[model samples]
Target chain A: MTTMADRTDATTTVPTEKLTLARALTLGMRTALRHDPSVLLMGEDIGRLGGVFRVTDGLQAEFGPDRVVDTPLAESGIVGTAIGLAMRGYRPVCEIQFDGFVFPAFDQITTMLAKLHARSLGRITVPVVIRIPYGGGIGAVEHHSESPEVLFAHTAGLRVVSPATPADAYTMIQEAIASPDPVIFLEPKGRYWDKAEVALTPYGTPGAGLDKARVVRPGADLTVVAYGPTVHTALRAAEVAAEEGTSLEVIDLRTISPLDHDTVVESVRGTGRCVVVHEAAVSHGVGAEVAARVTEECFFELEAPVLRVGGYHTPYPPSRLEHHYLPSVDRLLDAVDRAMAV
Target chain B: MTQPDVLDTVQLLTPEGTRVADHRYDPRVAHLDPAALRELYADMVLTRRFDTEATALQRQGELGLFTPSLGQEGAQVGSAHALAPQDYVFPAYREHGVLHVRGLDLTDVLKQFRGVDHGGWDPAEHRVHLFTLVVGAHPLHAVGYAMGVQRDGDVATGDPNRDTAVIAYFGDGATSQGDVSEALTFAAVNQAPVVFFVQNNQWAISVPTSGQTRVPLVQRGVGFGIPSVQVDGNDPLACYAVTAEALDRARNGGGPTFIEAVTYRMGAHTTSDDPLRYRDAAEVAAWRAKDPIDRLRRYLADAGELPQQFLDDLDARAEELAVHVRDTVHAMTPPPAESMFDHVYATPHSLVDAERAWFRDYESALEDGSVR
Candidate 1:
């Protein structure tokens, strides 16, 4: 049995290591549990199975059943109970096994969890972090592949964020746990095994905040913005665009709700064009919100209209046809090509 | 499977106002002094007055709507008084008596119905949660809070003052909701210290209790492995005794207990509802004969505990409360328009701040005639 001390020694000694997004999330939960006694993990199959994606792998063994609870297969109960636990002054990190399964808990999440803090007039703080693995790419059945980030982001009280890389996943999960407001942490399932070097140490200062966009790749021709699983596709598209002398900047919108409008507007003004990409449905999706905002804010600076590349207005197809349904590198480049046409 | 007989309900005070012995629950009520009984009676009387006045206010177009607990006063008051101050309560919308017993001002309770605030009182201060309008949703919260109480080492402490339990109050209709079933499951599995108080008031808006479940609600808890009892809800003494025992058992780490307080809704589901369209007058007359307040009044009178002066003073007190509710409800004003954006999140978000600023500008623009 690896004791807490031994685990700490191992993490501290390994200053930086290449870890997958799933492993980084596990490390983040571990850090949260070690830092605060109030932190708890609850979900179906999250305890014994370490989650279907193994995002919470080995956490139950280390944290004990009390802290890492395996709940009954009821999404509403998991989230509703988490609200009550939050009211009792515990920071509960709830895992909604998959994105599509979140609908069962939607009433609890949107009505009670999202509205409780405000209804109490700040007397109560629902410090809950709801982690959902979202987006399509994995050849899985229905209900497993979906990008429902916009549903939470549109809600007033919730703070919605998605992390593409392992390093940001490691840091942002802890930040979401530490936040006083309820946060919807959309984990990119397709990127779960994609590895990158992550600093074991904490990022930024204590309470440095997590609602900001990051410029992953710099260019001057046009700004290509994406988040979560689609971020890598945008980066690859940017690379492909670079070879053709078309300088395409890539911006990873870490926070979806607040939009980090300043960073996005500045980038768009610099490039004079913009293209937004997401895996959710095109109409009223996060991409649409971004397109609307960019059009509103950087209307005068735009050489071309802000374009959007996203899933068609249809249900997430079966695994066999998901490739055709979800946004791809070629689709993003085609949008970029249209932007350059102006 | 055969359904449990409805007559198996536990009763201490008969509908005729006669006190009777309850073998299982009498011990819990043995400690209630004359003063406590009088206090319980006063709680019911004042709560009824408050509820009636709120309903009248709604009819007069002063408030948006009102849900009256006119007939279930005994159940709410008795169960609420049975709880200790440290205990937490998750109330469904029609818990006026419970809120009053928990020390919430009548005017504060009316704020939500008056369209002034969602919930005017702070739950942390009173240990009473805000009214959950969604039926059966709060039981899960109650169970979760009980689990937290358990985690805090607040149960099985042997000290009655330190140990805590949670009570979730929902109507008979809520039993059909999936959340309530899940709550029972969670409460049983965790062995959490909680009391599931189902006031089987025989009506869920327009639908009758028969439509909700074929078996008695008490039996529903038994299936979930929770010890359950059915009490004559009109008998405050019985309600008090059963709830006290259940809460005690829970505080002592005895796990969850379900108490189905058998009662009736003598009024419409809400001020907006019309009972005449669905039910007959004979049914209302039958329940009126078994009025909880009248039975209690007869008991106090027969026991020689009530005097003419005391009865008159109680009437005057009820009138005073009615006036207070009416005046305060009328005096209540809507909060500032910009205040709507406050408390949406614990910390400030640029989006909310921007929206608040835009609203302020829009309001100012309208005031100064900048645009139509």
Candidate 2:
């Protein structure tokens, strides 16, 4: 177990270790709980069952039932009670079992949790984090794989974020917990088991801030902006595009709301072309916002019009047809090629 | 469902202005002296005056809309008075009496209806939450706050001054919402110190109470493992006694209690609603006979507590309040358009700031004739 002293020491070179995104999330929650006495985890089956995805495995035993609560199977109740808990100065991290189940608690999240701080004129702050596993490619049944990040991102008074890698997953979760406002933390379900080397320490750093977008793979030809599950696809697409003589700069948008447009605009100006990709529907999605902002800021510098590649404007199709429904690496590459052609 | 039994409803004052007695609740009633009784009566009267003035304001186009708490004064005033200063209140939109009893400025309450502010008063200062427009949503918030009180060791403490209880106010229609049932379940599981006050005014817009539930609304709490009772909402003494007892049990480590205040909405649902289209005039007349204010006034007169001078003074005070509301509402100025972006987040956001700056520039450019 690493102590706070060792974790904060910049002089110490901590050994990097490989961990899956799920394990990293668990570690992040543990770190938050250790850091603040007000921090608590609330969800159905989060205790005895360790959550459906096992992202919260062993946390109940380690932190005790008081900290890791197994609430009744009601999404609205989970969020509503979390709001009350937050009002009493407790930082509650609530987990929705699946992306599709989030609708049951939408009223509590959007109406109550989102607006409380603003309605109270900042006197009352809802420091609650709602963790949702979203996006398709899991081969699960209906209602299991769906990306609804756009709904919350569009709503004011809410900060929506998603961590695409293990290192970011470890740091961003804690940052979300630390936020004084309510946060809708969307986790990419398909990338839960994806592993990468992560430094267990060095949080709250300038580069590790929750709202900053990182250029994971730098290039000069065209800029590709993506988040969550699509970030992996975009990175993979960039690798494949390199062999085909296209240098694609890939940007992982950590925060959906309060978008790091400075970084995106700078990258777009460098490349003079942009492509936004996501798993949500193409119509009125985060991709649309990114495309609009890029076009608005980099109008004169653009060699081509900003393009977007995303899921079709339809309900999440059956698992068998989800591969065709979700944005694939080939589809992303096609958009990149179109931008380059223009 | 069978009609609600007259005897099943708890009452200390009858519809005919007779004072009755309940062995269980009479002691609590006895604690209130003549001055306290007059004060409670004045609160109900003043609240009604405020409601009437606001309604007239809305009709005259001085305000946008109004939701009058006409016939439900007994339940709102009695229950609000029962709360200690430390106790928090989570109220639905039609809680004019509750707001008055909490000592909130009437002008502040009118500001929202006047289209000046969303909620004009600070909830923290008053220990009363903002008026929640979303039905059945605030009960969950109240229950959650009660859970926090439990965790903070505010309940079961021998010190009554420090022990806290939360009262959640909702309506008959709100009981049908899933969030209300979810609130009950959460409160029961946590054994939180909360009182679920349901004002069953017999209508959810055009839908009747029958459409909301087949059984009496009070029984909804029983299935959730909460002890509940039905009260004659027109009887102020009964409302006070029942709520006082419930709050006592909650602050003393007893779990949640649900109180169903049987009343009627004697006015339209709002300025926009026409209640006459759905309900008969005869039904309205029947509920008018059991008016909460008239019943309280009759009881005070019969008890010899309402002298001619006292009645005259109360009338004068009510008129004064109406004038104050009118003047304050008329004096309110619209907030700057840019103020909307101020409180969206506790911390600064780049987008909000940038948008605010852009709007400022746009306004200045239009003033300078640089752009339209």
Candidate 3:
């Protein structure tokens, strides 16, 4: 119901609206579809049902059935066809219903979608975007609430990115769609309802981009790195740390596959301490990669061993134990305290 | 387990060098004159020669691997020849006959086998996608591509050159794959202008077609609500007629069709596979007697359609291609080590760029004798 940006140019003053992350993503997809005729949306219930999370609420009616297709309930078919559609010059934005549901299409994603560009010797470019509502929170059970970003990040051909804020959700979706390579767009389902004043401008912002890591809050002591759902937890921990006279620099790694190594390395080089946080399991997750990179790049500048705060190396537990399973403000603070102790 | 008759499968040209008339599909291949039939015969012969040369190359350590389509040339060429220039093809790795029909350079295909490249030709230029090694995955791609063609308003355009269709080539083994089933469902629901060409070549490595399916593979398509048919895969005319009818129906917006070409694999699944361990020699001999090329050759020779000059010219062409494949493969070298870092992503990634820079430095250091 909120009126998105009416302005066409950068200089025109655009109004900011308080929007949920889900609404922001809907508006982002709408903006992209309006701008490019080639961009279309495909998924199970994305058309008339507006997606389970309602991320694609009204775009289907506006764009017509051809542009916003409600595909048959098959994950591998959704991704495999998207690859084919990409080959035929249509940039398809596919919505995988949930994070765990993406496994059905994992073979198509990891083998065909990821490797086509490289194996074809740069002859083919699949500008396809797979939007997965990821991360565990809420009261949902099993496949509905899961964090599967790291599974895709390990693949070379895919550009894996997760947006933290409503504004980021708005812009990053368009950026992911515009990318020539296939992208795994992980939307933090936990933060889908979180509201923020989003600048309803066109895709790319001057200073803020999709691939780079943004240093959200600056400090002189230790640095906290997180993405997607955990970024909020990291900020809350930073706020508490600030009141406690402990200056904690918080960096939101918008893109995970590329890692924004320069920004993380630069921040760690300056702060001399770093703690990586995520909602995925602790071992061999994003935290492990960040820790290894940080150690290799800033080993001499370290004040302590790089710490990681995340869920245990077990399947995401039931709702009753989810809070303990997921990285939280208290868990992040605990990691901070340990790093400070070192 | 009885031998299927004309009531079960479409047989246009019998293995004994005779043409069988069918009211429904006879019109489909009516345009193929004697010259066209000879050309189709030449394509099959050339495909077999290329397969033989590639197999020899693999044995000689020139190729890393080779997937031979020794007996399925009739199924492959017939289906491929039915395609329009605008029509796209998604082929399994063994579709050398389809590749030949699409006018792809055999030497370029050898690049993949020789380990010089993963895929050698530009798919866009030829309207043929790169060979898919993964079983049953490409059928979904074909359906998706057909969906794209539909969106482009290229279907049912009434203009032969404007309207387009897509064909996906997979085997009986791929029918059991979940992706293939999904592709059939999507194609039928969307009425995407695509054809599912299943070359039921009797085996998927060590397993027979019976292991992959309980009923006829054609019935698999019918179960998904797509129109399905069975054809004599050893008869090139039947393969062509059935595929042409399906493609026409697709281009005209009649929806998808599934054609199961019943055939046999005269060779092992690949160069590394030995058929002597799995199947009976008597079965091989029976299928060998029904050789697709021999069927066409006998038909042409008996019908006074085969000229001595044409046969000599065709033989020379096949030999020349074999020599070219051998010479090109023998001269191939591994691509530059730095090239490994290329094309991982179309856009630049910091990690790949950093690794490439490090590799360059390491190689230079080695050249300068600074480090090993």
Best by TM-score: 3
| CAPRI quality level assigned to candidate 2 from its DockQ score | medium
Cα-based lDDT at residue B266, candidate 1: 93
Report the C-alpha lDDT of model 2 over B1-372, residue by residue, as the tens digit: 323222378998988878887788999889798889899999999999998999999988999888999999999999998999999999999988999999998778777788877777888888998876888898988988898898889998889899999999999999999999999999989889999999999999999999999988988888788888899987888999989988988999998988999999999999899998999999999999998888878887888889999889999999999999999888888888878887898777788899999999998999999997
- Model 1 residue runs over 4 Å out of place are A1-14, A202-208, B1-7
> Candidates' TM-scores?
0.97, 0.96, 0.97
Task: For candidate 1, give the lDDT of residue B156.
Answer: 92
Q: TM-score of the candidate numbered 3? A: 0.97
User: Once model 1 is optimally superposed onto the true structure by TM-score, how far is the C-alpha of residue B68 displaced, in angstroms?
Assistant: 0.9
Best by DockQ: 3
The digit string of per-residue lDDT tens for model 3 on B1-372 reads 232222369988888989988898889889999999999999999999999999998998888889999999999988888989999999998999999999998788888878888988999888989986888999999999999999999999899999999999999999999999999999999999999999999999999988998888888887778888899999999999989989999999999999999999999999989999999999999999888999999999999999999999999999999999989888988899999999999989988999999999999999999998
Q: What is the C-alpha lDDT profile of model 1 across B1-372, one tens digit per residue?
A: 433223378888888899898677788889987667878889999999998899999989999988999999999999999999999999999888899999989788778888878878999888999876888888999998998999999999999899999999999999999999999998989999999999999989889999999887889988888888899999998999889989998999999999999899999899999999989999989999888888888888788887788778889999999999999999999998788898999877999999899999999999999967
Task: Report interface Cα RMSD per prediction.
Answer: 0.8, 1.0, 0.6
* TM-score for chain B of all predictions: 0.97, 0.97, 0.97
Worst 10 residues of 2 chain A by lDDT: A1-10
Which of candidates 1 and 3 reaches a greater lDDT? 3
The best-first sequence of candidates by TM-score reads 3, 1, 2
